[model samples]
Target: ENNKHVNDTENTLKRQKTNKKGGPKRDEVWEYFIVDDEKNDRHYPATYYHCEKKWQKGKLRTLKAHLSNECLQCPENISKFWRDKLSTELTNYTRKQKTIIQLPLKQYQITQHFSSDKPLPLAITERIDRSLLKAW
Candidate 1:
């Protein structure tokens, strides 16, 4: 029937939208994160996210949605690329991201009360300066 054909066409279009070939996929939204490196260098993750204050406050059961980094740049979307191109591009990103030396990811938990909209506190800056002076 014509209706059946139309339905099939619609489904195909939906699936094709996410396929990584010759077109943009709308399924996954990209997120970038600024992860801290071992030597105080900052490396960004493809998707960066953390627990939200509301989640901690018990008002919300889940953390906030993932947010992209301000400076984190996303690589070009290479939809439907062949295996060889995919491998080469991946290797390039890995190689380019390497610093003087590769550093292990350090995971630490801190009880900092911060909201996404709030800026860093003055006291924190002062403390950082004081700590640096002490090191000097």
Candidate 2:
């Protein structure tokens, strides 16, 4: 039936939108995280990443940690790109003067006390900072 054909076409289009080259396309601005490297046969299981800007080559595990902790120290071009983007977004948000809801002073103090009992991990803190920067 024509209706069945239409349904199949729509489904194909939806799948195409979600997938590219057999992998789902990531929506995030940064895609530096390492996946399995399929290029070189010699390093089948070993991980690696190439930094074109600095002409530096590194292993995936080490590079992932370094990128997460010291994104600002990445190759100059990449670092500058992120810095400019964040700065512009922050400047625009500050200029807007949007009203942010605030917790009462007493409630904030109590919450702080509970939070102080357990420190957040460095990775978690870094993730939170990145989320905020992206949101801004």
Candidate 3:
């Protein structure tokens, strides 16, 4: 019985840790818009406008866009602050993504001749190139 109690306590702690790992803390944007419980679908995140009371389905960035670009519910001063904050965040994100995508790998250098045991056919090579480009 004592061993079972100790096991139960350990199991509860493990469950709590797993639960905490599943969800990150809510973003600050949640203060402006609230999840629309009535209209929310499990597959999508939904929020309602304060002024219009309309339900919108989108990710956090989409909500930020709405506040920064289209929403008229907030007062001029608050709206301007949010717009500037979101704009700065977007600019930083764009710069970071650009650097990550543009930076070339230093470890792998191209050679004049194919280093593989057998060179891939031209058709297969072109297909792979196209697929990678499309993926990016």
Q: How does each model score on lDDT?
A: 0.37, 0.49, 0.61
The prediction achieving the highest lDDT against the true structure is 3
- Worst lDDT run of 10 residues, candidate 1, spans 55-64
Evaluate model 2: give its TM-score. 0.26
Prediction RMSDs, each to the true structure: 23.3, 22.9, 16.7
Give each model's clash number: 3, 0, 0
Taking all chains together, each candidate's TM-score versus the true structure is 0.16, 0.26, 0.42
lDDT of 3 by residue, 21-54 (tens): 5556646665554444333543234553346444
Return the clash pairs for model 3, or none: none
Q: Which whole-number lDDT from 0 to 100 does residue 27 have in model 3?
A: 61
Off by over 4 Å in 2: 1-28, 35-69, 94-136
lDDT of 1 at 50: 26
Report the C-alpha displacement of residue 9, candidate 1, in angstroms: 0.4
Clashing pairs in 1: 20-79, 20-80, 21-80
